[model samples]
Target: MVPAPGPRTGARPRRRAGGRGRGRLADGHAAVLQERPCWGSLEDDALFALFRKTEPKVQEIAPGHDPLGDLGPRGQCRIQGLDDDRVQWQVEFAVHQLDGLRGQDDGRWPNEFLSPAMVPLGGGLNGMVSENRAWVALPPSCLGRPGEFDGPTVVDASVGNKDVELGGERGERDRTALARAVVRVANGTLRQLGCKDSLADPGKLPPVSRTTPTQMDALCGIKGLKAPDAERESLRRTRVTSGQGGPVRTCDLTHSGRPWSTSVRFMTVEDPQLAKIFSMAAMTGGPRIKGTKGYGTLTPSRAVYERTCRTGRAVFLVEQRQSDRGYTLPRELLPAYAESEAGRLGCGPVEMKMPAGS
Candidate 1:
């Protein structure tokens, strides 16, 4: 992006967001590319303008999280509670070429919920193995709310790149074909989710997740899911009872015949069974078991219990997008589905990794 011999000829090329190459807005030329932040409570455009006008007290290159694979620039903006306070937006830009048009847009998105509660999302633009010349932009975060991304879901978005080649009709047809193909892919994918008000002001939650489902993703009747034979983990059984002694065990698999350190200790009780205990139990407390760190209900969640009780044919649901031991879960659980009852839940059911009948 060197200036062609003039007063601004010494202009240095700025490194693009992806570090793929370089770019520079020509001296004295106003930028026509448009982009806005989506994850915060305030309007990003105006906030960003005010942000740059004021200097940030803390401005440093934030390092990426190696354990989580989230390298800093996630487009999460934190605007301080002051008038002159700036917003730190973890924004990433996508740079590409299209005929005479070039712009930049990346999807480091925002959320209605905090981390851990926020459904995970991600994608990549691998130039090496893409197999197609047309590069499509995918959002880096889920557009749905806290519980929205829990079920099978689909994700899609696109934007213009920032490098417009002025060369004469070079690869115009090829580029045109690529653009059309990208549009087709986007249309096909979105259409599968039925009609949605994508252009409407998506405020805090998504325009799509307008309705929440009743049958949420919850833990089902306890079933054994085993690890790989190579792991050599053995199954064990022990007697357990509720506070006042209700048969909390579902056969030998009240929790799992095959051991699994689940985030929470879960058991599905029939409404009839729960109804009896309903009269005997206290106003606001579940059975408590005292033990070491490996105690009962490793991670207790009342929300998980409510969802489980509401559904039939017990399914061990994982509200999170993915499991810690990926190999223990099924591949179908990772995909995005349209907004069905299961889809709206944002997460999928966990298929016990153990033998089918075990």
Candidate 2:
């Protein structure tokens, strides 16, 4: 597919094969895609379908542009889990990018802007945002499990497939395991941008906050965080029988819908399973845990989507309650982000307002 031009042009677009060449189609895209050892595509057409599709009049923001600038109250975030017979693992990731341009030598343009991106290592689309159909629709094959899933989660990674020694501790084990996965993915994404680089030790990274089910059910007419259809029927039933005081609780779930959604695919070659991982998301959408009311989905506005597609900027996510949306920024990265030109625009401390008619 041919790429239309957007933003500034000092460096020629690099190929996925990793070299400075006139931006051309089918270069590294094939090799880079092949480099991903897991997940087979139905066909080449399927591989490139998402890459070539585009939205009408999409905003043409570049990768270096900051997505946080126009972020909504509850900055969105997501976690992913995958396990094959030989492995079990989880990683948390988000779809945000750094703000603004960079010198040819900056990490954002590492190797002197020769490669399309220093991090993510794929998708050399011309534009960075929604207009960048190629980057947004990156084939599932390009994303591989960064490490061995030898254990149910990294918390148990060193244990390497041992049975959970404790019977009732599975919930705690799952929570911690999911928490660390985000750190690993966050560090991986941070390698490209100099700003907000991950700490040498990933263990220190914080786990994203998850939403409770009751809290999720309370709201009415929120965006992506709608109650499952069955639950909605239950709520209707409660309201009908009990009147305003019905047993049904009222809550509002508001998601930015910016980053879209995330999927988890796990495989194990040792004893059992094998594969790899989409959706447009305001924030990185995460895993599905039982008993949890909210799945941490978001419905970001068009502005937020454009920002995320353009930059792929922020590497991590922070999920908070709709009332606490403005505080969604991860505390660890808060300083660097605040120092950024966009952060300085007073974007911080954004507030999430619940809808009326509960």
Per-candidate clashes, comma-separated:
21, 46
Model 2 lDDT per residue over 1-358, tens place? 1122333545543212222332334553321233211111112332223222211010111223233333101111211111221212321123332112221111221111111111111122111111111111111122322222111110001121221222235533433332333233333333333234332321221221132333233222222322444333222211000112111111212242111210100000110100001112212332211111111122221111111111222111122222222322222221222223123222222222211211
User: Mind sharing the TM-score for model 1?
Assistant: 0.20
Off by over 4 Å in 1: 1-90, 93-116, 119-198, 204-358
Candidate 2 global TM-score: 0.20
RMSD of each: 22.0, 21.0
Ten consecutive residues with minimal summed lDDT in candidate 1?
98-107
Residue lDDT tens for model 1, 13-88: 2321211222223442212113222221123233333232222121111111124321111111212212223333
